[model samples]
Target: MKSYLAPKFIIERDTERCINCKVCVNQCSFDSHYYDADDDKVKSRIGKCVGCHRCVLFCPTQALTVRENPLDYRANYNWSPEVIEDITKQAESGGVVLTGMGNDKSQRIYWDHLLLNASQVTNPSIDPLREPMELTTYLGRKPDKIDIDKQDPQSIKLKTELAPQVKLDVPVMFSAMSYGAVSINVHKSLARAAVEMGTLWNTGEGGLHPDLYKYGNNTIVQVASGRFGVQPSYLNIARVVEIKIGQGAKPGIGGHLPGEKVTAEVSSTRMIPHGTDALSPAPQHDIYSIEDLSQLIHALKEATNYTKPISVKIAAVHNSAAIASGMVRAGADIIVLDGFRGATGAAPKIIRENVGIPIELALASVDTRLRQEGIRNQASLVISGGIRNSGDVIKAIALGADAVNIGTAALVALGCRVCQQCHTGKCAWGICTSDLFLSKRLNPDIGARRAANLLRGWSHEIKDMLGGMGINAIESLRGNRLHLRGIDLTDTELEVLGVRMAGN
Candidate 1:
């Protein structure tokens, strides 16, 4: 007795081009293809396909085609097929519906609404190839003002010294993806890529793999509510230690690594019992207030002997600006703001779709609040959630982000199709599954190299954009909202973004 829900994808094979090599049957991990021994031909269970197209690539004969299944039900704009199907799924399973990747709905993409300005006769644009365009960014606290020693006027020795900063050659870095959520090779690729690109990769909640200790210089180890794999060594090994207060995908909720996904290796890394649910409590019980946050922030600094910067990460909620201010005053040298459209390995579908605001608004608001409070120099701001390309990175910097973290895009480059089946523990791509067979699909060297290439290409694009703006350094773009102009946004949107209309 199979469920009557319509299949989302249709797997078609051209009979004339079929060589009967059975490669399509063997390649698909979803069991969509099978050999019919009685008929001596290959057949497909179209309803089972997630349309990842992995088999299409392996089919040497080019006989396979995957497409979206035609909708049979009457079209209604409000209660659409996806909504109806989700209801059926929840009714049948009696479980929370799950999805992977990011939000798939049409929402206000502020990046599209904001346009970048270019230099003209008054300020001629510089050629990136011929001029010196700087893309390197340092993430950490900065001094508000410099005081020089009068005795050594020629040397101009600083009275106040600078704090520890993680210098990144590129403003884009790979975001957090936990060990139980993504394969070890994925982590290795991120670590290797960060090292090669001169950036840092965040170890999301999950503990750092022992093999990756060598790349600790480029690692940003996290201490979330679960405190998974958090130790003195964890604090000391990384260039920065981040505290994960909440995530954009499921704000006010905790992380859920299903018992089914808790493999032996994952258990060892998370220090939890095998085949048991690893649920992080919604709030760090110790951190009941902002003062409590200060305790933990200083604790990490103390453990690291004040050698590394401490970052506090929070979801961009309605009061994100106020919360960011508290975090900066609480001894945080860096602040990470994750918006609603952020990707998650697993989260309740309702919470994923309906919670939090966009990163664009959150970043603009938080940066303004901090600057107004005169704490802008107290901490560096890093933002994430639905950052699609180099343009998005450039726009984020213009809106006041020191750096941007990219998770879904990096995974896409590593062959992820975003089929939204991550909760089932059977990711079609090797990026987000613990299954040994599936994990083998991603080669670490290739994955790392691909990640590096993405950063390199984006870095070049950033330089190009900067040169067009007549700005020589990346810091000049930070919080420089004057360089951006709004298109069709409302009065409030423009005011929140601190930008003018395109014409004015």
Candidate 2:
């Protein structure tokens, strides 16, 4: 079992007042409390508590109280409440903030501000249960037109074999998160879930773990600047190859895996010196310009023998449209736009809140620019960075995305409280930490099943939304501006969104 020496805050329950309702047990997203069948009492494994206050707030009897251990350090001027709390815990243990995935602070989650529309009674909502509800989606370029030679069927040759469609059972995809950030068990769980659910999971810029090769057909290998654990064999073993330009949490800033967290195994996989920081440089050495981007794309294609689709992922920014256009021109088969306000393992507070644009505006602008340039159909669009539920997924598609990538939501399904302490590595919930004992708290089978259930639930809801719109298939919803309308938006916003007045 992995060992740690950090002081912990414990949540105690008033045994006299505890009625064994299991309310606190169920309400605690961290799974800190459980029913002790032998003792006939509710017990809290307080070490798992992240002080989210969910249990305290939800306890009907107000019987729960959380207190910091005396050993917990007091904050000094150098460390604010948040910083002190993080450092105290991590400093005592000497570990990275063990977060599951994504940044999840109270930063602006734009999806909430921008809402979806359901067909009015006048438009007539179709019954999805009775009718055929279509959620099947293809994630690749669509041909503008199919040429036919009716006069000489045998003589006519095809322009080229069309790119194969990335057949998603649902429009939702598991977002990129590295194996090192999470655990190999966690990676296996995600891969197994993806294959079972007919979706895809991204192998974050961290190279593919050899153990996960079985799920290759449903995997998308990611290549980032550091080239950590990347090789021709790794590149060749994926359904799609994604080039990560930036992340929503820290757009221009790169990731730093402190030397302390670099285990021998992790060091070997990443091809870095043991016990030294594994720094992913902010900018790729090969990609200085759009032409340079093309060279890297070609290199990957050559390495993979051009079998897998190539995707470029960029953080949403003010110039996202221009950047996306350049990526398409750089031979990207798909483009993933990660919005501002997305979750992260660890990022400076200012950068997390200020660096990137909202997914809504970025999606609209990029789609409009690509369509205007007559190149929208040349590649697929996948939007990430705070996609919360099925409604957000449907709205993203109608706004012009081919699919949605979810990191935060998937982690929630696997038991994350979003305590915002991921960087400190002592994830009370086993989902994020690498500690053997803490990690065992999450059973990979159960976690993977839960994730699969969440995806299945969302798929059903998406189908219901599409059916309510009188739309039969997910493809019909792709870039269907006519089915959408803006609310509380200014004239300029409406113009940018390509939506007119509600009645019109």
Candidate 3:
């Protein structure tokens, strides 16, 4: 909180050309610009500026410019200019390389290439305004078939149904991020938002904060290798339990929360020693194979009394279909595929960009394989990693996903510039930081509203897309590849996507 070790970049305004239109003031959320009471002139606080360039880009007059301090370190190319600079800054202070949200680089985010379609003039589009659009979706394992006829007419059924459904108001849910990695207030915000929106929020591998148990109905507690804060009581409070296999940002790596960020509250919640690093092992010891995964799943089930759904989240890779199929057979109620391009608080840049397959292909392949094996209904599939907009969500559903989990996009809605500094715990936007003062910049109420608005907007767009496709419900759009056609795809690609050539 004292000072940013790297020399700061400041934005200066040309007062001669500046009108008191308050455009820059309105544009900047960082409170960098303020009106001087005495002179009625706009003043800028250089220390507060994040150099996000929002004000500069939106300024009506070309009156603003940003410049870095002369003492700032010059860019180097040891491991790409960006990586070199990030490393240089972090090394200078000996602090963690903090970042917000997930990996963001031009690494073939598959959603861009795949396109969505609408019905032609010959086909009629449904009027969503006049008719109800079903956005409600259910998560958890689904039954292949129900048999009630075997029961005697007079006999009462004593045993309860095996699996219960966890319904979501929207198809999108918040991704896991632990209390220690973020803040309790941030967790509370997400919890309240999930409750209000009727979605779910993941507890990440950091374990559950006792204060957040009130949102248990909408929470998905995670069990990672280290099992930092996990207990039978903690496991019993969630509607869903996600087993963290690997994250997209650091596929083969584990997470380490330095002692500096693990405050007393975080320590207590995570049940780790205070002033010690919280280390989550790269992989669970019990899960060495598909059979091992089932054992762990059953262990959790036994601990939680089989009440909650268990989700296995893995980074989407080349063999995602086969892995997901194995997960289904491993008693997984839900399978979450985190694409390689997914974001993390802090991860090795090499892993973020170079690892994993795109969600589009992963989702399509998994869905196809599940259906082919006739186990598509055995467990639900949720896709994550780079879903940028509503079109991406719709396309993902069409490619065969029960729902999607959004992390980077949600933070952006809450005012993140994707600066990739979340690991440092000093987010300019305040959404990803633990500093109470800086964190206050994000009013959870307003943040939740903005997040809700984004989801609502996307939902409307999804409905519009579905309407144009002559689909009355979103379920109808799920896995309906007949509504899609492949363009510029090779024979193998076309075959994999289950689409015909453009001309045909």
Candidate 4:
């Protein structure tokens, strides 16, 4: 069958400046660039380009230009170019259209609709450079009230017993991206960067490699439906244990790591046979009800000797607020909400774009519900999915997120271009592939420095934003919707976000 699918990108190489150095020939993993021996020139197969820009960056002469292929299809509002292409792909392959990364649709980004308040006449803004600003965040269950005795007027005693907590210098942590789906070096970079930034990185259900045990203090090992590598030592070595109930990209479904990505190390770490695909079930087999979930939580606490916080991660669906309420009552010390925009190594394109609610709505509703129920202190809340910058982080904090996770942003820091071709396992940047040759392209030291630098920069920006609001500490911003104002938002949106419209 002659495919009707048009090339997604167009690549042009200038002959005047072309040196035919074969740099692009070796750089592009997609086989878009080629060396023509007969013509003694470098050429391109434009149809093969995924637009990752590997050749453009490595090109010394600046002779290459890659841009979106302007294939002029008849304009149809209801049927978009992407839609048509997707239909075409399915017709040819007769398989589910798979994509990598988050939803690229034109959904309303709540972060853009919201604006932060700045102090002026009534309140004076403090200069972060001159004043001591606090971004310290603690994630875990908090006591409803503390009973203290000021015995000597100098010392206090008789404090209520507190649950285990994971202290972070900043209210930002790395999101879970499993080992087999990505590479070992990616995990190494994330772990090292988490340690450097005084934050934590999650080992997303794929299990922890032996090389990462040293960074366990900054690790959050995950237990999912598959229970790939849930061993005693794995639980004991981490600062926190997270049960991944669902993810935002493809909620209500399981995860699949292609057999090709499961290398020997991944097999050893996950306790699976070599080259076998790892498929996590949609639900934990033993967890049929909230009671079952509570039991598992208690069992994990017992396994950890009551030392670490147990976090339950769920995708932000319509009833997220209600679900989160149950999780806290079930003894979850921390609850993680992954929004629709969360990234994944692979997922059905339809599910990634169609499923899950926005994190903003879910966060506000959950926080409000928990507060109304007087159980807000029972667990801390962390949100992920589509957190782009420090501004998003601060807004999320204002909306009641204890902290925010950055998955795609962190990958971008480590040389990812958001090409959305991660499912192919032919990543030229080496950030998303398990192939040894491509994996080596990403140096762990460099990747760690880049990711850590991103956190440092964002933390500074968060402090600056907090100072502008006359808030010296990030904790003060939690659930303070008064500091947030909606712009061009509907009345219902304003109500749902718990914020007044701009110019109110």
The estimated TM-scores of all candidates read 0.97, 0.82, 0.84, 0.98
Writing each residue's lDDT as its tens digit, candidate 3 over 287-348 gives: 88999999999999888888888899999888989999999999999999998767887776
lDDT of 2 by residue, 412-481 (tens): 8887767677665555556555555556667879888988999999988988888878778999889887
lDDT of 1 at 81: 89
Q: Each model's C-alpha lDDT? A: 0.90, 0.80, 0.80, 0.93
Where does candidate 1 have its weakest 10-residue lDDT segment? 420-429
- Each prediction's RMSD over C-alphas, in Å, is 1.4, 6.4, 5.2, 1.1
Task: Give a tens-digit lDDT track for model 1, residues 1-504.
Answer: 468698889988999998888988877878999999999999999688987888887789899999999866887898888889999998888888887778777889999999999999999898999988888899999988888888966776778888898899888888988888999889999899999999999898989889888899999999999999898888799999999999888899997899988888899889999999999999998999999999999899889999999999888899999999999999899999999989899888899889999999999999999999999989999999999899999999999999999999898888887787777777767778888788888899999999999998998998999999999999999889999999999999999988899999
> What's the C-alpha lDDT at position 56 in model 4?
95
**What lDDT score goes with residue 137 in model 2?**
77
Lowest summed lDDT window (length 10), candidate 2: 96-105
lDDT of 2: 0.80
Query: Number of the top candidate by lDDT?
Result: 4
lDDT of 3 at 487: 70
Model 3 scores a TM of 0.84
